[model samples]
Target chain A: MMSRGEPSIRLESVNHWFGAGETRIQAIFDASLSIERGSLTILRGPSGSGKTTLLTLMGSLRKVQEGSIRLLGQELRGASQRSQEALRRRLGFIFQAHNLHESLTARQNTLMGLQVHGPGGDAARQNAAVIHILEVLGLGARIDYLPEKLSGGQKQRVAIARALVSNPEIVFADEPTAALDKDAGLHVVRMLKALGRTRGTSTVIVTHDTRIIELADRIITVEDGRLLPG
Target chain B: MTLLLHLLLRRTPIGWLQLMHNRMRLVAAVAGIAFANLLVFVQLGVVASMNSVIYLTYTPFRTDIMISAPSPQLFGGALLSRRIIYMALADPGVADATALHLGSMEWKRPGGMSKVLIVYGMAPEAGAFAGDTITDQQLAMLALPNRVLLDSEFKDVGKDGSDMAIKQLSPETPLEFEINGHAVSAVGSFKLGSGFGYDGALFMSDQTFQRLIPERTSGTLSHVLVQLKPGADPALAVRRLNERLKSEHVQVRTAAQMIADDVNYMNTEAPMGIIFGIGVFIGIFVGLVIVYQVLATDVAAHMKEYATFKAMGYPHRFLLGIVFEEALIIAFLGFMPGVLLGSGVYQVMAMATDLPLGMTPGRALTVLAGTFVACALSGSLATLRLRRAEPAELF
Candidate 1:
């Protein structure tokens, strides 16, 4: 069981490689970091700087090759597939290109965030929760529209709604605001910050977008596959 | 259905939604499946009609028992000697026995066009076989030399050449035709339709048949038609006749057994039957390929979304469920149109060729079950690509 005092994510001497033998390339090098609850940390890096790799390692999307990654006080190194899957449900992920299913409507895609936990009680309540979160994301009018019918920013907002509707303990965003305009981007960050303060949810965002930098509680920079001092 | 759809929508129909996302692709997939189903149905229908023709040809000769050489098909192997008929009559349970000669001969139409006719020869003393259109008077007419009875219901529309149009001859029209270089006149006509092997049939006396087919000796017979005493059980009569004929290389069968043996021969040994069976398998292969293509494309297009699902903690089983659901939907949707079109084709073919060809409920159900299994198989094969769906790749 995790205590309230434990940081949401802790990494120690984490190293990751991309390939094997002649083609092998080290993606992340001797990285160590801790992200506390209720804190919004931003990972800023140039292209191929391993910030996204670090984010994936912390989010349990990638296997730990050499060092330890403790997510919500559960060790992810050499974790079983079932255990990794269980740990994934505690976290939310937003990709760079709003990867919403083209066939699903906005509301239905948002519902997928909760539905993955497997058929919980009260579908009506789940639907209400989905709708409420979409409304908060300023997508209430487009709830029944497919991804093709929505604009770029609207699609990204739908992706965000899908990520946050489950109220996950940790949210990992990769350029979540790349497709959004200034106001929409600010609205999304503010929503994440509000969730952090109210529910003690931690957020780790990887982006080159300069607008939301000041709003982050701590900004970690990555250069040449290594993390610099905050 | 509305209730089912409502429940499905409430559960977030990811699989259904993904299939419906691309209407054109869905249509192509369904069309492919429907085409495969149509191929199977038509092939099955043709084979079934061939079987029914076998039964219809033998319907007129239905009797208490039939004695012939041990051959898989009727009139297929060696000819039986009339000695078997006398041996069968020796049974106390047997009433009498008649030697029936059967052969196929080419009829030269007026325009030098040729048509094949199945010829039957029996002793004029033997009255018309049961269920046959031939009456005692018709049998008497066959006693006259160089005289034959034609099948009035023969339809020669699709039998090779249009010049051989002797469509629906009447007894009033005593058509003159030559069979095997022997001049024979149709004194009257019978009501037997064409079967799968022959374009028409003719009935005549044994002497006239011997005259037309000179190679067949006087004692040569195709089958010995047996009649049982009214009070005798058919099984006992057959057993007794078998015992009486045990010395000879011949077998005795009831009318039902005769039909079953002929039908089984047509299904298993005949080249056409084997070809049609292979056609059914080819249709299934075509369906599998089509469904695999559609599903592989769908999986490829949505690889990233699926990886996202995996990252969201959804198990591989959930993804498999979605794909298999799509395959099931395709199977059902395609089956309806295929069946409708197949029934239409059966009707057209039945009219074009006077054969008992149509869809039975059992056949329809079998195809439906086949379609489901095929699509399910395709679903599993397509999901082999899903094993490569790594959540880490989506990053």
Candidate 2:
């Protein structure tokens, strides 16, 4: 963690669990990391290594139990759910399932990310920005199509476009290319790194896909909820 | 919540759009509305039809005033004197007045003593009051030595179902009644009741009533039913007549006043009011519950979407507006089918049962207005859950 005006992503000795008492599964155990702005970090791990859990914790989806996790310099545990969602306006998210609201078109889905956080922006400008993002992300023609209408590669690209449309300060992606073929997977990886670099966003991608290891700036491996040496 | 609405609506008018997506839920919701409305229309129409039919039957009487002695069944107060009747007619503005002699008597039947029957006496052609159906044949029978006009529904009165076919007097002209040994011709047969509505009614001349009533020689009457000239102000005439007849122990009023007095008499110390009161309360309760059930289910199904909006920072008021919009839609669409179907229900009741009934647009509107308020209030019960549910809890 060399250069930091504010660490876009930070976690300190965080722990989390599901259920209570007799039936609890500790998903994140003693995890800590700092993502500097504009750095590209890859969290590489095997199945059930708590990568998704850690990502969600940092994303403010799950409330942390024992320790503090902060995003964009704001403490996650102290903030209300609404405040956390507001912070998500500046935070992009990508999941393995590519969970797009099934009813909305790709263009509209991307616009939702922008609308959620920005209250009272000009409609015309928002439309133009969304169109611009779709075109830049190579989804210009497919923008009007629903998720089921798009190919796997195109869906992931639409997801990428949605993540970046808000111009979030940090992007957290959980295996964005896991469902794509090799060529499309490589394209997704290259896009994540390039988009982050272009916007000066801290991008942390959780991936088990080994084909695009060369595309990451630095890869950190995790096993059994503990961070392994890079 | 406006901001959240702006976000959700900005996504699509997915509220309506979503209905297009799930045709089944849409159909179910609409069906729920239809069923709920059907119940409202049917029950309310039955009640309204009865009240309106009674009103129409009596509203056409040409009487300027009516007098009756106060009683539970008596709406305008019942049984007044012949002296008061003559004095009211003597008032300068009062063009003409007549006494309506009404009382109940038992018509002896072969099997046993029959039920009590109502008897009314007034001029057959004079316009103060009229009777139900009394045909020329029935009138001849009444004029003859041994016959009286029987109820249209009472011919199979004592016979077992196997042998006796019900023969309704279904009379077209006047019939006759026998008191002691004298024959009294009935000019008409009213629908089993007076303006104070009883089971069966018989109309005859005052002379006939003298034979039927023990006090007939005393020259008293049930009360006076009156009529005014073409251009007379009824209210002014009533005041004068009341003053003129005060010495004779009487009161005077227009036909409308008489009806109001009747209604007041029925409502104020009458058991009939209890029946109407129970009916109204049950109507509100049944209507409120069904509407609330539908609205609550709709709210529950769509609550996640609302939560998503809340998560995005929409205010509570906008959400409330959205819920109320749904309620208004239900009130109108649901209520109209109910009214139409309710009319059908009332029609069946009128044709099949003895209830006095007629459905009017005014009554339909009144039910709709009441239903709108009930549904809106019930919808509020559903909306508060949406307004108060924490967005994070939904996820």
Candidate 3:
């Protein structure tokens, strides 16, 4: 285990490719960036810019093939499976699609975030934590409703609650507001900003939403699989 | 235990919830499983019924040992010489012995239709039969020439014999029939049921049997029934008789050995048991396929959701657990209806065929265990596709 350090994430000279032989194509090239504690960063890029790939690599969802990525002060280059799993536990992820289990209710979906830690603590406390997060996200009345019954924005809120309920040090979201209306999108971004200031939880989002771009503390742009000057 | 149960209940029942979410798919999967179970139950039931028939057919003759020609099937071999009965009586373990003559002949019914009847010719004494309906009085009735005892439960001689134009024969409603063109009178009745090969049975004295079938010689016999003395071991007596009659063209066996031999012959030599066994295999295959389809489709439908779970660091083991849970649930749910409906079918078949066919605890447990294992195996295989749901692709 490595000691805690400043900046939730640090990447240096990261190079990644897909496939092999003649079919091989590079996806990330000599990219280096660092995200600080309690900061909201947005990854902005055009289509086929490999922005999502960079996000996944930093989130520990993808292996660092070349260079070094230190997530939470632990180097992820050639890391063992166990260490990777441990790193993933300290981070949360949200996709462009809400990806909520259609069978589970909003409260149940939120509870899954805690469930990943395995059985620990009292059931009552877990239930209280899940309920508090759902209510905080303005889903108190619809907590018992399944995903199919909720609107697009409400489901997105449930997803957000799921990511934040576990008290993760950093969160990575890809286009988290694409399905929401203008007001809902703005409200979600402001909520993340508030959480960053109050809890010191860092966040990195990938989106082209103009409203979200304006609220970002930092913006990184990628074009043709290469990071440009921020 | 309470704490464990509480913890278990606290965990979200994702598998059950997912299965219940698709009502139509669940119904189809369950129906497919039930149909497969039904097929297996009926096939096994039919084979068991055949065994029951053989057991019941031999239940009446209460002899300690049987000396007969070396034939696998009963009443379908070369006739044994009556000297084998005399040789069996010489054994100190044997109390007495009697020769039984068996033959099958076409009997002309009242409506001019002919049906085959199995004839059992024995002496006018109670030495051969045990405490069956063939009592001294019934044997005495058979002593008179051309007089025989009819099987009251006899329907007909063949599969289509039940359609014959003859009322169910009882002692009170005596019927006259001709065997091999020889006129005979059925003055009494017994309770031996019809077997698969013949429609009915007739009991007569050796003299009357010779008169009905003139070609049968008096010295030739089908079986020699050996009655053991009090406290005599049948196995020892049978061993002694086989040794004593080793020089003769005959075999000695206890009643149980005879039944075992017959069952083995029917299962291996005849096609009925083999065909039914194949049916059971086909049933299991069908059930496996149905469960696989349901689980695989479910995993495909929720690929993205599973990917989300992976990204959440839930581990592949947890996802595998959910699939297994669904399989066990389906197994339990489908087995109940399948067994219930199977028992009902057994009752209907028993009533229709008059065979001792019913569910045994052992059979039910075996099938239940088989179903659980098969479903679990299918569930594990179905999760292969789930492993390919890459969280990186979710973007």
Q: TM-scores of the models, in the given order?
A: 0.87, 0.64, 0.87
**Top candidate when judged by DockQ against the true structure:** 3
Residue A31 error, candidate 3, Å? 3.2
Order by DockQ, highest first? 3, 1, 2
lDDT of 1 by residue, A96-201 (tens): 8888888889988898999888874588898899999899888889999999999999999999999998989999999999999999999999989999999999
lDDT of 2: 0.63
Error of 1 at A181 (Å): 2.4
Off by over 4 Å in 2: A1-4, A22-25, A117-121, A135-161, A217-222, B1-11, B54-395
| Candidate achieving higher TM-score, 1 or 2 | 1
Instruction: Report the TM-score of candidate 3, chain B only.
Output: 0.85
Worst 10 residues of 1 chain B by lDDT: B157-166
- Cα displacement (angstroms), candidate 2, residue B157, comes to 23
Candidate 3 per-residue lDDT over residues A105-164, each given as its tens digit = 898898888888887657688889989988877889998899999998889889988998
Tell me the DockQ of each model, to 2 decimals. Answer: 0.62, 0.13, 0.63
Residue by residue across A61-150, what tens digits does model 2's lDDT show? 667787888788788887886677667667777755565655567887788667766457788888899999899867889888988799
Ranking by TM-score: 3, 1, 2
lDDT (tens digit, per residue) of candidate 1 on B109-201: 645677788888888888835346777877777788988877776655234343333433334545666679888877777666767767778
> What share of the reference contacts survives in each candidate?
0.78, 0.07, 0.67
